[model samples]
Target: MATILKRASKGKAGYGKIQFCGEQARRDGLQYFWVDTCCIDKSNACYVYLPDVSQSSSVLADNSNESWESFRKSEWFRRGWTLQELIAPASVDFFSREEVLLGNKTSLEQDICETTGIPATALRGSALSDFSVAERMSWTECRETTYKEDKAYSLLGIFDVYMPLIYGEGKDRALRRLREEIDKASRGTSLFKREDFSVSFSLSDVSDVEHFVARKIELVKIHKALGVDGSRRVVVLHGLGGIGKTQLTVAYAKRHKDDYSGIFWLNIKDENSLKQSFVKVAKQISREHPLALRLSNVDTNENLDDVVDAVKEWLSLLNNKRWLMIYDNYDSPKLPGKTDPTVVNIREFLPELY
Candidate 1:
């Protein structure tokens, strides 16, 4: 590993890396390849000093009896330039001092975790975004960089954000900028589309999420189906009660409320509730939608069906606006019998969008 590192840092790129990378990219049907070591910006590079193991450091030798430290503490481990090389790659292979075939990061993860103090999942090359800010920061707790600015710059790929080089800025400010960029990235639109159900979304509703794990992957699939690609624009999650479907949706809304223009949760647990919720929602939609108020002529004599029909009409329109509607707890088609012409099933009230 040390020999290869030395050669990689040398003035000449003599390892046949260019041809090898080009061939590998071609085999993978890719247009190009990127090698960080080959194209490093030496202007922003950090240096590491390796010592001869056979001869101890003269300063340590001169002092009284002292314990020997292995090359694990070498500058290579501490240099800021090396952290990304260790982490950002999908997989990293390690070779012995004799250059014999050893193993890749996955094949020897336990040792890597014990040595580096990084979590096994991260060492296995999980997306940096999958881990929290604190978890990512802890990976570099003891690592070092020659320039204060490189400490933050080194983590650019880890956080998956790009900022202009500001070498003179102190480490604190640079790190601050890095975190700001990460926060901006975290705010990117998620698939959890929410409809305005006559009430503002409350994070408190999902505050009890400690006991419930986030079903983000499932929610993402549903989000993509309902929100993306402009096809199959409607989705229904049908299952027996107490299956965590509602909680999963609430968790998605709480986590990604900022991504959507609006979020609406309809309590279609029963027909009366569904109709009432729809009428209430129509009044709210009337403020923004041109057709809603005209259709919802809420005279004292107006029937409940009139309001529901008006609300459905407002929702079915094809517009540039984006919103998510959850027809929650739709366990049965039969509405709780109430008025003269009872609400029979869900198909009757739903919007008619293709």
Candidate 2:
């Protein structure tokens, strides 16, 4: 360890990654040298006062049922320094302990997205404005720091901001301040907008909703389902044919129009209508969205199944703004077990909840 520091301190190397970084920097015509090691004083240590009492924080949430002892046992994840190094750069390339070249941030985006539940765009270094507050919190949920204050300090760069680092302020206070900054920066912004594209709302015209009576509970349920940080959700409302189920949904949408980027109302009178509606949505996204072609699961030109799948993939994206789809007047496909085996059901094309 002493020898490694000596070589690095004197702009010399022990013939490994340090040498490679210098060479790469020279190729890029950069005279400055920077390495995570020796760049920051790694030897600076802090002692934490672990309390016997359990503290409840809403920001941290209930990440696990495990005891704090078990949580602290995973030391690598509990380190404050690692997350800062992971996200503070414009682009990051990683290497194994054996010095094997893994990939840059963009190259391993799928793995990152799957691991962190962060959108692909954010991993590729898109602006922090592209993510929601909940999304930001989820990224650091599994991480920890030696100092109570540093758990919050590590996230400043992730959110692309700076704050006065008061080491004694405590992590919860630091995190709360960080959130305040985030809220201030993100203030007055609409949750759903099409800043880059010009696409019209595709749902059919509805009768006036000013007089429509609101069903508050169902509306709240839909909001919660959409806002939940995990899987995609589906809420099914079943009742007699003339029970105002469709009206209830329409009224709910009218009440909460701003909550979604788009609201699609599918009048499922028959299989043909469903297919036509799905295809229309696919074409709309393909024409209007920048990622439409990249996200294609199927070729729209060749087959109907592909187009529907493409639409599903587009909507499935976190980058895709929140959207609400109501399958009003939906009916079951099977007719009392007298089903034709060859006929394709329209319900099959609907996007399955994750």
Top candidate (TM-score) = 2
Task: State, as a TM-score between 0 and 1, how close model 1 is to the true structure.
Answer: 0.37
The whole-model lDDT of each prediction reads 0.58, 0.56
Q: Model 1 off-target regions past 4 Å?
A: 1-74, 188-354
> Model 2 Cα displacement at 300 (Å)?
52
Give the deviation of candidate 1 from the true structure as CA RMSD: 18.2
Write out the backbone clash pairs for model 1.
Answer: 194-262, 194-263, 194-264, 194-324, 195-263, 195-264, 195-324
Please report the TM-score between candidate 2 and the true structure.
Answer: 0.39
Q: Write the per-residue lDDT of candidate 1 for residues 1-354, one digit (tens) a residue.
A: 334545575456434443444444466466544554632332221111233222234433443323223333345556666767766566564433323223456765665676677788776556566665545665676778889888788888766689998989887678778867765776644321222322234434222446888666897887677763433256877777877877888877777676564566677877888777776666555433322334435542357787777766665655424556667777656645645344447777777674
lDDT (C-alpha) at residue 50 in model 2: 21
Model 1, residue 273: C-alpha shift (Å): 59
lDDT of 2 by residue, 1-354 (tens): 334446555544444555555655566566566654323322221111122223345312454434233223334334556554545455555443333334455765655555545577765556665665545655665666778887777777666567899999876577677756755655576541223222346445444445667668877876776673335557878888876777778777766676666667665667666656676666665444422343233455567666667776666655454677777566655456657654446556666554
Which residue pairs come into collision in candidate 2?
none
Enumerate clash totals for all models, in the order shown: 7, 0
